[model samples]
Structure formats: C-alpha cells, structure tokens
Target: MSSSFFGDLRVVLRGARFRRLFGTRLVSQFSDGVYQAGLAGFVFFNPEQHTSAGAVAAAFAVLLLPFSVVAPFAGVLIDRWPRRQVLLFSSLVKAVLGVVTAVLVAQGAGPAFFVAALLVLSVNRFFLSGLSAGLPYVVPRDQLMMANAVTPTCGTAASSLGTGVGLAIGMIGGEDALGTGIILFVAALGFAAAALVSLSLRYRELGPHLEEEPEEVRAAVRNVLRGMLSGLRHIGDRVPARDGLLTMGVHRVLFGVATLMTLLLYNNTFTGGGVAGLAGFSVSAALLAIGFFAGAVATPWATARMSASTWIASLLATAAVALVVFGLPFSPVLFPIAGFVLGFVSQAVKVTVDTLVQRHVDDAFRGRVFSVYDVLFNATFVLGAALAAVFVPPSGVSAAVVVAMVLVYAALAVGWTVRARRLSATCKGRGALWA
Candidate 1:
C-alpha cells in the first residue's frame, strides 16, 4: 500500500465503479447537509422555536429515533435488493419527501414539520448504508482504508459546503418559515440530481452477491431480528472490527453530549440566539470541515505507518486532553478549536472502524452489519443526549458534562490500547490483522 494519501487515491479512483459510487455519496450527503441546515435554522436559530436543552433533546429524538426503527428492516432489505437500485430509489423517495417537508416547514415548526424532516432522513439511512456496503465492490481490497478516508471526508466537505449555501438561502429569504422552506426545496433538487447521477451504474454494479433466492416479505420481517443477531455474532468473532465498533460507540455517546451542548451554547449563551448564533454555528461548521479534511488526509498516511489500533488510541487520548485544554474556557475562540479537534478525532476513528467492518465482514452480511452500525451510531448518540439533558443547562456550560466526556475519552483510550496489545500478542500477523 502507498504511504501517501494521494497515492492511495490515484490507485483506487482508477476504478470507474468507485468513482460512480463516490459521486453518488457526495451528492446525496451534500443534500443532507442542506436539509439539516434548513432544519437547524428553524429549530435552533429561529426566534419562533424554543431553544433549550430539553427542546434540543426532543428534536434529536424526533429526527433520529426513527432511524433506529428502520435499521433492522433496512439491513435485511439491502441484503436482498441490489445496492445500486437502493441508492437510486432511496434518493427518489427522499426528493419527494423533501418537497413535502418544505411544505410542512412553511406551515411553521411543529410535530408535522419534524415528522416530514425525519422521513427524508430515514430514507437517507438506506442511501447511506448502501454506500458503505457497496464500497468493497468498487475499490481494491488492499486500499480500502484510503477509500474510506477520501469518500466520507469529501462527502462531509460537500455537505459542509451545502450547509453554507443553504444558510445563505435562508438568510436571503429572511430566515423565516418561508425562507427555510425555500432552502429545503432547493435541497430537494439536489436529491433529484443525485438520483440522476446514480443512473450511470449497472443493475448489479454494487452487490450483495446474493446466491440464495429472495425470501418472502413476511419471512424477511421475521428474520430482521435473526439477521441482526447474526451480524452481531459475526462482529463478535472479528475481534478487531468488534473492538473498533465498541470504540466508535463510546465516541458517539460522548460526541452526542457535546453536540447538544454546542447547540445550546450557540443558541443561547454564545450569541443569544439569532443571526449572530447562526454565524457562530457556521464558523464551527467550517472549522469542522477543515478538521475532517485534515483527519482524512492524515489517517491514510498515518495508518500506513502505524497500527490502526495505535492510531485510534492516540486520537482518543488526544480528544480527552484537547477537550479539557480548549473547552474548559468555553470562549468563542477556544470552543471552535475544540470543535475542530473533536471533528478530526471523529473522522479518524470512523474511517478506521468503517475499514475494519468492511474488511472483516462477509458480503452476505455486509448490509446488515452496516445497518446495525447505523443503529449503534444514532441510538447511542441519542442516549447520550437524553442522559445529558437531565443536567446540561440551556447556557450549555456544564463543567460536569465536559468532565464526563473527558473521562470517557480517557477510559476508551486506555481500553483500546490494552486491546491492541492483546491483539498483538495473540495474532501472528498482528499489524495485518488489526490494521
């Protein structure tokens, strides 16, 4: 494998299938950013909506809990259906739902508006799961790490760019119900464009390589639980991937708490909840993009030289120290830097875990594994937010919450380091197995 990130990219992007899949991810996630930003403005910055820790938790639950509900079905179905078609059709559904969501947003922020938004995001879960499951089909098995790094980082960058554009639309249109609706409608067009791009792929372009006959709907529904358990068991047997996932779950919960805290800080204490708060939010978003890009660039090169476990342990430890050093102050200058650090940590860990899962899991269960991964990602985050809502203030300044995140990061770092040592001891080719 190449030590240089660009070298890995040059080798991997040479595949036409990879490029098509990568393009689909970029366009779809970019639209996701726009949709998320549109909703964020309405829920967090709009004077009309209430901004509180409890409210933030409620909004996250409304948007994310449904993603958990759909994961089992999505996993089982993705394994049965063609992944290429999954991306194409899911995008189409999202486009239609986005329009409906825009119409609802114009009626004012309510349960109906959130329901519409969540529907768009729920459909998005399918599109995203397909991207992860389909990646191994596109790239060389040897360079999966670089592929993971580049695709998600670039998708996130595209999403961040879309966020700025959406916010600009909201601002131009007055940042009200009508403005937010316009932003969402424009975002819907992006989804349509994504669907158009996905048309380039052949029917079996991205595959589960299914050898068995398709199961009946009732049978599949009954099998969802069985399938997920199978996935979990499969993961448990792949020690490295299972450990990576456990590490990821820990990061998500801490990250989730920090996320709500940031929302509250921006909405209330940091800027007093208006365009000023939005600007601060935008700055953090931009910094996050930079951090993600840096992490992406760094991971491929760094992991080329070190074990994946070592890199992850280091990053988690860095997160613990960075949070206390930069976040304790909670000054505008320091907090954004903290956001950047966490962003980098997030991408690096995720890129590692994504590669581990894809590398270890069989194609037959890949979709199901990624979908269960979907549940692990969102469900844990929501769990964290719900737990934090009990204590985090509207001002978003909770020394105790920050302390909790720091301690968790530290503990996870130690645990991962010890596991890396164990993997090294038990495996003949430790680097090859873990990395």
Candidate 2:
C-alpha cells in the first residue's frame, strides 16, 4: 500500500463522526455483497434457471433499471430532507425488503422476486446517494478526496468479502430455497446493523443547509424532473465535472460488456462448465476485487503527481490497450489477468471521477448531481449488457465483439486524452481536478 493511502486513512478515520458514517457504509456494502451473491446464485447459477445472454441482460436490467429511473428524484430527496434520517430509514427498509425477498426467493416466486428485488435495490440507490452527499458534511474539504478514495473502495472490498461468504454458503448448503434464503436473511441482519450505526449521528449533521423553509423543500421534491434537469445544467457549467461524468459514463458501458462477456466465458467456454465455471468466475471476481483495491490505493498517489484529467486519460488509454492484449484471444489463462487489469483501470478512473465530482460540485446540488451520476453509472452498464446480449454469442468467444469493444475504448481514450490535454494546459489551479 502507498504511504499516501495510509496517510489518507489516518486522517479520515480519526473523526468519530466520519467513523460512524464509514461504519454505516461498510456494513451496508457487506450486505450488498451478500445479497448480490445470493441473487446471482438463485438467478444464474441455480440448476433450475435456464441461463442465456438475453436472460442475463434482462436480469441486469431488472436489477439496475429502476435506479436509473428513480435515483434522480431520490437525489432531490437527499438534498431536501435530512440525510441521516434517509440513511437510517433506508437501511431499515432494505432489511425488511431483504426478508421479503428471501421469502419470494424461497417460494420460487419469479415475478414477485423481480418486484421485491427492484424495490430493495432502488432504495439502495437512495441510501448510497445520501452517503455521498453526506460525506462533505463529515470530512473537511481538504480530506474530501481521501474520504472518497477510502470509502467506496473499502466498501467494494467489504462487499466482495460478503460475496465470498455468500458463495461459500451456496457451495456448502446447496443453491436451493433454504440456503439462498438463509444468505439473504443474514444480509438483512447486516442492514439492520447498519441502521443502528446510522443512529449514532445527529439528524442534522448531514445537511443541505436547510436554509429554505419546509414549503420550498416540499415544492422541490414535487418537481423532481425539474430538479434533475437543474442538476444536469449545473454539471454543464462546470467543465471538470462535465468531463469527469462523461468519461465515467463511457467506461461503464465497456465495463458492462466486459462483465457479461466474462460471465458467458466462464459459464460455457471454460473447462468446467457448471460448478467449475462458477468457481473460476469467483476466482476472477476475487482478482478483480483486489484490482479495485489496488486502484483505490494507487489513484490518490498518481493524481497527486499529475492532473486528475491527465490520469483519467492515461487510465482510459491503458484500458484500451488492455482490451486488445488480454481480450483478443479470450483465453482462460488471460481472462483473470484481463479481469484484474480492467478492474484496476475501471476503478482508478471511477475514484478519480468521484473525487472530481465531490470536489467540484457544491454540497447543495451534490445529491441531485450524484443521482444523475448514478443513473449514468448504472444505465450505461445495462446498455452495454444489452448490447452484449445482442452481439456476443452463448459461448462468449466473439472476436468481432472484442474488436468492437477495443475500438470503442481506443476512441474514447483518444477523445479523453485530447480533452484532458486542453484542460491541463488551461485550468491549472488548486481546485479538485488539479489535485
């Protein structure tokens, strides 16, 4: 680990309030990992379910589409309401939903499962937005980037650990109603714990200034679409924020494609098809999680040395190259390496962009803006998965698909490089992106 990484941790973790906030996110994310793993096991890995490219894409859409639809409005709530309450209530709701979902999954209720799962994840979007919006309140501006670096990345790690536990349960207990239900119930318990942690903070601590009276806030909530539009206009005015969101958007699309491709390859093309393929996929996922951690560690240091714009462009270019080198052949040997590289580069770019947004965007509009960001973050991934469903075959050995992805990445890299070059030359300052 980099010294800067440790140094950043020391600074942020010293705050009791920040620690409580971090604890809420950590426990919640661990639950996320377990819930997601259980869902995947039930939906994709189970012997009963017939897995296909379209089915996977549909699952992705079901899992994420509502977030894209609902988060913008939820962002309005994050800005308008007390975020501490939002976090607390959201956690409780998630816990209840988890129990409901477990019941649905146990009963093999397909349509009901989708509905319950959608509700669970949609609230999850709100909870996450509140956390992002609330961070600036707890951590000082100077440490904001560091907080961003540690929280989400560590949350990812926690989630990954949860996933491992969930997978272990599945492997040991069998992927049936009883076992999956148990995992989800455990996840619900974790969410309840997160809710308890949220109570440690004062309700007003995570604030939107609350300068306006209750009537104005109510009106703002009513006009969610307008609020969302206003947030976009805010991003439009800020060059760095605009660019950062754009870059992350494109990256997410590629990530979605890469994810689906990896799934297909492991499920169908690998030496072990069913249980073996899942094991291999899990190993790849573990490596990818490590890569995510590595990126989080390295990004702060790398951006310290260069403009974040430059770093973003560089990472994009690196991903472009990685796609060709590791993706072209699509070998079993190369798959894990490719997954690690992609995970690292993708997360590095995300951490950088997240810092840019949190730093550049003001706290007043942060929730709304992040909601927009969340939409792009998830929607693009779904779009890419949908495209992969259309293009990639069942075996996932498509040279054409790989080549197409490479071109997209390369084009984005060149474009981002050109844009970042201009920013580096013109916008030299002590602001967020310059650090």
Candidate 3:
C-alpha cells in the first residue's frame, strides 16, 4: 500500500509542465528562505541598527510593498512576453543584485548598502509575483491546489533549513567579517543557481496570438491600462469574482497580521544563544512546515470529505482560534505546536480558496484576476506590517496587538462565511459554471 501511494505521487508529480516549474520554484524558494533568514540575522546582530521587532516588521513591509504596487503591470508584461523568458530575466536580475549586495557587505559597507540591497530584493519580489500570476497558464485548472500545496511545502521546508543554517553560521562568525560575508555569498550562489534553472525552462506563449503590425502593438500598449480598468469593471459586475476577491483580501489581511506578530514575538521573546533560541526557531519552522505539508498531502482527502466553502469556513475559524491562543501567555514549548496548527489551517483555507478562484474565473482574464488578487494580498500585508510596527513595541505591546488582530480577523472570517453562504443560497438554482 505504501509503495502504491508513492507510485501514485510520482505519477502526479510527473504528469504536467507544472512539475518542472515546481522543481525550479523549489530551488528559488530555498534561496529566498536562506536570504531572508540571513538578512534578518544580519540586522539583528548589528549594534547600530534597530534590532527591534519593528525593524524586522519594516523589512517585511518593504519586501511586500511592490507586490501590491507593481503586480498589475507585471501581469500585462507577462501576457506580452514569453513566460519562460520573463522567469529567466527576473532570476538573472535577482542574481546580479545578490552578488552586488554580497560584495558591498564584504567590503564593510554601511546601512546604505543594506538598504539598497533590500530595494533590489523588493524588485525581485515584484518579478516573483508576476511569475505567480503566470502559473495558471502553465498547468491545468484541476491541478491548482496541488501546485499551491507543493510550492508552499517546499518553501516552508526550505525556510526551516535556512533558519537553522543561518543561526549556526551566525554563531560561528562570532561577529567576524568572514562569517557575515560567507552567509551573503551563499545566498548569492543560490540566486545564481535559480537563474540557471530558470534559463532551462521551455517557453510557451499565452494570451492572444495576434499578428498585428508595429503600430498596432503600440496601440495595444496604449490600451493595456484601459484593458486593466475594464477588467476591474468586469469583476465588479460579476458577483462570484467580486465575492472571491473580498474573501481572498480578508484572508490575506489576517495572514499578514499573524505573520508579522509571529516574527515580532519570536525575535523579541527569544534571544539567540546556545540552545533555547535555536531550538525554538527550529521547532517553530518545523511545525509550520509540517502543517503545510500535511495540508498539501491531505488536500484531496479534505476536498472529498467537505464542500469547498465548508472547508474554507472551518479552516479560517480554526486559524483564528489558533492565533488567539498564540496571543495568550503560554509555555515557549507550546508556541511551535500552536504555530503549526495555525499554518496548517491557513494553508488549507488558501488552497480551497485558490481552487475556487481558478474555477470561477474565465481563462481569458484569469491572469489579470490573479494579479489583482496578488495586489490585494501584498497591500494588506504591508498594512499589517505597518500596523504591527506602530502598535507592537519590541517588548511590551506585542501580545495585545496580536490578540486584537486575531479578534478582528475572526470577525472578518465570520462575516465572509455568512456572505458566502447567502450568495451560495441565492445562486443555488442557477447553473453556474464554477459550481
């Protein structure tokens, strides 16, 4: 039976273009995990910089801001360019930026260098959002949940490894120049490898195969903004699309706030040293990874057992409760387990929701819809990070902020579920394509 299960998994993994994409995405995500942990460690260890929770929150905000602001244009660009080329170019750009940052840091550059590096990293994130927008084109609609599960599982696992490695390296460096430079160098190498994998992808053009003249292409460019505006207008007129966007927005806001709180609590309450901090970080990451991995592994089972809407509502409620518990005073040992539960439920809801969106939206405008969703997702996270920075101090106010955020999210989840249920009832007799 175990062999049969493994054989079935292999078949699923090998049956689509998305598998190759997933493989490359795993490498890139691993690099991203390492870079993020290393960067956080760098900022925390430096005496002059603000080693506070707020600074870490700010870094996250900076990283996420572009996804909101730049994703629409990225969507248009992806539709215009070959998807493979876009991914390759984005990876190359990131690799160059990584190398440059490493070189500057190794030369004993100041805060300006780090800031510049972060800015470049943020742009890289914009490209990543574009890549995500393009993913629907690379795979069948039915496989979306699987793709989502696979990507995040790899990411969380990579994060766990990167965090452990970064902590160990930080300990060895002992404020030495070589230690810091070595971590940065490793990150640069990861980016380079991601670029190479990106280059290996096969290109397939998506969207209208128009054979327009140069002048017509310019005209099309002029109309791109108008087209985007029209798409938004179209979404507004469509109830399912509108409802889906609202649902996604609420979920993303909660996720962003919770994640910010987690980072703040981890950094503030647990200081790096011999065993405690290292163990806590490792356990927390492990729990998160396990949760996501479980969600991914059980997605088909969950879908079979429950309606999509039911699964979403139940999971969101569970996550909210978990966050509330996370905010309450608990043993450090309990934190990782709590985090794991939250991560699992949140990802399950996300997978259900994403599947819904893919089902509801038409192929013609799917990329734009996904891009808009990405923008909302990023914007909410930026807002959450900013709010966390303002309200949650390094030491005292974090728990209160986390509790308040959880309550707010819980309220949103309740409202969303009610609205969804009513909408479902209203459309019950109608033969909707999504249903």
Candidate 4:
C-alpha cells in the first residue's frame, strides 16, 4: 500500500462522527443488497418464472428506470428537506414496501409485484443522495477524499455481504415463491435496522440548511426543470467536469451491456433452470464484488504513477481489449473472469471521475451536478440494458453484441486519449487542470 492510502485511512478512522455516519451508510447499503438480491432471485431464478433477454431487461428497467425518471425530483427533495429526516423516513418507507413486496411475490402477483418493487427501489434514490450530501458534515474537508474512498467502498462491501447472505437463504429455501418471499422478509428487517441506525444522528447533522425561508411547494415543483437545466449549464462551462462526466456516462452504458449479458448467461445458459442458475449468478456477483474492492484498494496506488486522466483512459482501453479476449470463447467459466475485470476497470474509472468532478465543480453546485450525474448514470445504464435486450439472445452468446461493446469501449478510450492530451497541455500552462 502507498503512504497516501494508509495516511488517508488513518485520518478517517480517527474521527468519531465520521465513523457513526459511515455506520449509517453501511447499514443502508447492506439492506439495499439484501433487497436487490432477493428481487433478482425471485424474478430470474424461480422455477415458476420464465426467463428471456427481454424479460431480464424489463426487470432491470423496473429496478432502475423509474428512479432515473424521478431522480431530479428526488434531488430537489434531498436539498429541500433535512437530510437526516430524509434518510430515516425513506428507509422506513422501504421497509414497509419490502414487506408488501414479499407478500406480492408469495402470492404470485405479477404486475402488482413489480409496482411494489418499484416503490421499494425508488425510495433508495433519496436515501443514497442524502448520504452523499451528508458526507461533508461528518469529516473535515481535507479528509474528504479519504472519507469518500472508505465510505462507499465499505458500504459496497456490506452490500455484497448482504447478497451472500440472501444467496444462502435462497439455497436453503429452494426455488419457489415461498423461498423468495422469506428472503424478502429478511430484507425488510435489514431496512428496519438501517432506519434504527439513522436515529443515532442528530436532527440537523445531515443538512442542506436553507439560508432563508424558501419557496412554496408548488413553486419548487415548477423549478425542478430549471434546476436540472442550471446543472447542465454548470457542467457545460467546466471542461474537466464535462469530460469526466462524459467518460463516466460512457462506462455506465458499457457496464450495463456487460451486466445484462452476465445475467442472461448465468440465468439461461450456464444452469438454464432451477436453483442452480441462481447459484451460478450469485457466484458471478461475488466475483464482481471482490473486483470492486480490489479496484478501490488499487486505484490510489496506480494513480501515484500517472495522472488520473491517463489512468482512466488506460483502464478503459484495457477493458475494451479484455472483453474481446475473455468473451470471444463465450464460455461460462470465462464469464466470471470477465465480470471481475469489468468490475475493477469500471470502478476505477468511476472513482477517478468522482474525484475530478469534486475537485473542479464548486460546492454550491455540487448537489445539482451530482443529480445530473445520477440521471446520466441511470439513463445510460437503462438504455444499454434495453439495447442489449434487442441485441443479445436468450443464450447470452451473441457475437454481434460483443463486437458492439468492444467498438464502443475502444472508441471511448480513444476519445479519452484526445481529452487527456488537451488537458495535459492546459495543465502545463495553468498549474492545474481541475482547478
């Protein structure tokens, strides 16, 4: 490990309040894992359910698309309301929805189940946004980067842990609606636990304190569109922010394609039926989680030897080539390896993009920029999934789709090279590019 990595870890651990805040994030994200894993098990693995590429894409859309549509509104609410309250109430609501969803799943209620699941997933936008908004309050500004490094990475670990537990539950329960229902019941309890953690924080501890008494409810709704516009304009004005976000968006699209391909391969090709398919998918997911952790640990060390921009481009290029290398044979055994590589490379790019945006964008517009970021992230992901449904087959072995991913990733890498060279020249003249 590099000195910066250890030093950052030491500084973050020394803060009591940050630890508590981190705990809250850990609990919430863990519950998120349980909830999502249960849903995937129910929708994709149940013997009673039919699986296809389009069906998988629809499921992915149900999980994320509506939330993307409402993200701007959720961002407004995150800024307007007290964030501590937002986390507390949103989590509680998710708990109730979880219980309802479990009942729907058990009863074999189809559309109703999706409707309930959508609500359960949608509330998370507020909870996660509040957590991101509240980070600055828990730690000193100098420690912010380190805080970001530890908090999300740990939260992701907790989430992956929850998924592992859910998988165990699924294995014991078997591949029925009843088993899935039981898993979701446990997920509900997890959300309730997260809500309890939220209670430990002071009321105003996570905040977007209104400087003056603000707008009426009707007016605020009207301004949501305007706020989104202002955020776009803000990104447009900053070259580094725009470029970094573009890189992140491109990665999300490619990641989405990879995700759907993996899901279909495991659910329909590798096992093709029963509880074993879920187990296969779970193994793939676990490998991806390990890769995510590896990426976080390795990114700081890698950046010490190169600029973040160069590293970002290099990672993308590597992913592009590796996709072709690992995916050409299209073996089920190779998919797990591909999953790990994609997870590591994509996460490294994400961390770099996040740091770049934070450094370049001003505090006043940070929330808005992130809201825009969230929208682009989810939208591109949904778009990719939808496209994959059109391109990938039920077997998840489509040479056409593989070729498309390689081309897109390679093109993004070339674009990154051009942007990095321009930014390098700009930095030489100006002292810093991000600033």
Question: Candidate 1 — which residues are off by over 4 angstroms?
Answer: 212-222, 428-435
Question: Per-residue lDDT of 203-224 in model 2, one digit per residue for the tens?
Answer: 8999977574455444555577
Candidate 3 differs from the real structure by a C-alpha RMSD in angstroms, to one decimal, of 4.2
Q: Model 3: per-residue lDDT, tens digit, 1-435?
A: 111323334544764665666666767777776666556555544544434657766666656675567667665565456667766777777777777666776787676666656665655655555456556766666556556555656656765676667657756765555566666667667777877876556666333233443544435434668646645765677665576567667666656666655654555565442244434555666787788767666655666554555566667677767766654664466666667876787667666666666666654455556667778877876776667667767652356765775676677668757765765675554232234
lDDT of 1 by residue, 1-435 (tens): 676667767887899999899889889989989988898888778775558889888888989998897786789888878899999999999999999989888886567887888888788887899999999988878778889988998899899989988988887988668998999999999999999999988899888666553543224335777777777788999877898888898899888898888888888888877788888888987897898888888898777666788789899999999999999898888998999999999999999899989988888788888998999898989988887789898899999889988998999899878876876776565354454
Q: Which lDDT value does model 1 have at 376?
A: 89
For model 1, what is the C-alpha lDDT against the true structure?
Answer: 0.85
Instruction: State which candidate has the highest lDDT.
Output: 1
- TM-scores of all predicted structures: 0.95, 0.95, 0.83, 0.92
List residue ranges in candidate 2 displaced over 4 A. Answer: 1-3, 212-222, 429-435
Any runs in candidate 4 off by more than 4 Å, and if so which?
1-7, 212-222, 428-435
Q: Model 4 clash pairs?
A: none
What is candidate 2's TM-score against the reference?
0.95
Instruction: Please report how far candidate 1 places residue 315 from its true position, in Å.
Output: 0.7
Order the candidate numbers by TM-score, best to worst. Answer: 1, 2, 4, 3
Q: What is the lDDT of residue 138 in candidate 3?
A: 63
Worst 10 residues of 2 by lDDT: 212-221
lDDT of each: 0.85, 0.84, 0.62, 0.77
